[model samples]
Target: MTDLLETVIENREMVQPNHANMLETAHGGHVMKWMDEVGAMSAMRFSGETCVTARVDQMNFERPIAVGDTAFITAYVYEAGTSSVKVRLIAEREDLRTREREQTTESYFVYVAIDEDSSPTTVPELTVSTEEGEQLRRAALENEAE
Candidate 1:
């Protein structure tokens, strides 16, 4: 089994005007897309197979990111079932000039591995090896409560 902490993956995207809403803030849909992509990548890394999103739990937009900010998205597998992987995702915004960062969104997403036939496939067990991994797992569980 792969250590989930070591299997974590990250992705980033810049918030441009096209990715913003009329309010000039990052669009909710865009954030969701970014989260899903990062979460999927983590799941794939953990499973070593193609994966598809099965569900997204409690995605909360905590803050607004303005255009020109960079969105840093991180995803890690925290738990696993027979064919499912639960990923924790966080999106943070980095100011272009000041380089300040603030977490703008958080979510828990579930994905299922698929075989070449596109059927559900089993995945290796997830192992949390470090304090940071344990902390993220705890935070994900806590966020699920809210």
Candidate 2:
């Protein structure tokens, strides 16, 4: 078993012109790619096996992360099945100098663990060991409902 919090991964990407759209904000595809990479990392952490994305839930972009801003991403495994892991991902636009951030995108992704033979493999059970972990799981569930 693995504690849900143990599967959490957080990282930051500095938005550059190359990752931006015509409006100078982050391109949707680039943001989704970052989210997918982070979500897969969380899935791999929980499963201890290579994970491949199977599905991506609806993604909603609430705001824009402009060039020179930071795209702060947090991904965590909240649920698991025999061979699948469900991860919640959130992206925020951060002004590094001001230490301010606002939600820009949120989504859920499902990944399947793969064995050396390149077949689906069983994953460890996911657990919430502490109050913080429980709260984080609950928040992800609640957000997913919206």
Candidate 3:
């Protein structure tokens, strides 16, 4: 079994000119790509195998990250099935100088563990060993219920 806390992952990226769209803000596609990478990390960390993104659920874009801002992302495994791990992902738009951040997106991603042949393989059971882990799982469930 893998504890949820052990699967937590976080990353940050500076929204540069190249990452911006015509609107002069980070493109939605770029943000999703970053989320995918982080989500896969969390899943693979939990499964201890190569993980591939199988589905993206309920991606919410609440705000945008400007070209000069920073993108803050966090992801963790919150649930697991026979061969899949489900991750909760959050993205925030941060003003580096002010040290302020506003949530920009939230989503759930499902990843399937794969063997050397790239075939789906069984994943370890997910365990909530800490209060933070339990709360993260609960929050994800509640968000899904909404």
Instruction: Name the regions of candidate 2 deviating beyond 4 angstroms.
Output: none
TM-score per model over all chains? 0.95, 0.98, 0.97
**Most lDDT-accurate candidate:** 2
Off by over 4 Å in 3: none
Alpha-carbon RMSD, candidate 3: 0.8
lDDT by residue (98-144, candidate 1, tens digit) is 97889999999999999999999999988888898888888877877
Determine the C-alpha RMSD for candidate 2 after optimal superposition of all C-alphas: 0.7
- The lDDT, on a scale of 0 to 1, for candidate 2 is 0.95
lDDT of 3 by residue, 1-146 (tens): 99989998999999999999999999999999999999999998899999999999889999889999999999999999999889999999999899999999999999999999999999988899889889999999899666
Model 2, 68-123: lDDT tens per residue?
99999999999899999999999999999999999999999999999999999999
Model 3, TM vs. native:
0.97
Evaluated against the true structure, the overall lDDT of model 1 is 0.90
> Which order, best to worst by lDDT?
2, 3, 1
